[model samples]
Target: MPRRVTVLEVGLLVVLVGLAGCAGMGTSVESTATSTTDPATTAGATTADTPVSTPGSGYETRTVTLRDENGTRLATVDVWVADTFTKRYVGLSDTSALEPGRGMLFVFDGEDGRSFVMRNMDFPLDMVFVAADGTITTIHHAPVESDGDLTEYTGRAKYVLEVPMGYTNRTGVDVGDRLRVDGA
Candidate 1:
């Protein structure tokens, strides 16, 4: 006995026939369509929605209290101490208010020659790249929102000191100034 053809099967066959007619576009075009339309295939495209790393990351805050030669408290900065990708990459951005005695300190797990740039930043900052021995390698004055203008401190450093603009000069934190990082 022959089976009867159903309307649902006929409709599916017609839809497949129509899709087959439109199939031979190109490998690149097909792959692009699949990737752009499917969430699993287009996972990388959504990475931009992820939050950027910065001082305001949801990491625990570690206080880095500063003192002068006279043992006077010069500044007390609330720093996010984490050797993670998000914290290191995000640095300091979107900070509308930076208290006079506060700053962010990025501690690298290892020592290497590193450089920094200011992009998407709301305000200026003074970058003090410090070596493992608490010696400052280089100091750069990063300008505010100066897109594509990279300020690099070329030196082998394990720590990056980020403070408000003019804070370095105001506190007399010079290139030769020895930085004491958490009793180091």
Candidate 2:
């Protein structure tokens, strides 16, 4: 003779199984939240030489050297390289202040007529446009707009470097000069 389970026993068994399933679900959700919030596990974690995240922006830094037509090195700059579309779109807008000898370099696939604007910039900048052969095509001394009317600076370039205002004048870097990036 076998003993049959009572109606109350079956109901209790169902409740216990449901509670077990919920416990597993809670643990999964908690772990997912923790991983997402942890900086080390995040997507843009910094590496030894490539810092993907800086104070105000997430960009990798590179060393750029500007030279005259005679191959005389004029200046060396630590620049944030904006190679992708997203990085180029954001640019230096998030940066609070660019230290001396520091700037941002935008790289494109090919040389073309490009336009840049000082959108939401806290400080002024000197935009240098470079051709495919590393020759500079144009330099614009852009000032901060107080009237909220942004101006577009257009030039033919495969690379565009933006530095502190008056950087070109101070360094004597003008159009027809050349620029080279280290470990490019």
Candidate 3:
């Protein structure tokens, strides 16, 4: 027999969806896509000893830029592209501080539909999901919380860019903004 949804349950769902939308997240939970900027990946990178515009997890760094719809420069973020499986799996898991103008970019193979959780995160973050064509789809704020529930932070995105908590608001990065990656 099909399960019946109570009025309270439906109401709660509606409220939650509304809240997610207000928080710059999509109503439905989904995975992200590739890097919006398509930055080139190199083996040698700035390790813990060196912090020259370091990115989350201090992996191979790339220059990623976010611009407004009007072609205005917003932010120049130094990011580590998570192109491999291992790198993508351990993305910013135990990071405490992600300096200004720095973050991690999760680049997937194709159009992705998976959600990300804040596991072992010590600082708040703003995850920007971008399409393969470099279109910003959704911007989600992932607070420092446990990953027990694995609360998704984005919708059907091809690329996911995780930045500082206030990066979006501070830089005026809104959905539909086209971004580019330098030296990709």
Comparison by lDDT, 2 against 3, better one: 2
**141 Cα displacement, candidate 1 (Å):** 1.2
Cα-based lDDT at residue 87, candidate 3: 60
Task: List model 1 lDDT by residue over 28-138, tens digit each.
Answer: 100000001111122112244443333443665655544444555454455655455445544554444343344567777666666666644656667777778766677
**Candidate 3 positional error at 135, Å:** 0.5
TM-score of each: 0.59, 0.68, 0.67
lDDT of model 3 at position 54: 28
lDDT of each: 0.52, 0.64, 0.63
- The TM-score that candidate 2 achieves is 0.68
Per-residue CA lDDT of candidate 2, range 63-174, in tens?
8888898998777777778776546655766554544456788888888777777754656777888999899999887877653666778788888888767667767789
Report the lDDT of model 2 for residue 11: 80
- In angstroms, give how far residue 95 of model 3 lies from its true place: 1.6
Clashes of each: 1, 0, 12
**Winning candidate number (lDDT):** 2
RMSD (CA, angstroms), candidate 1 = 20.2
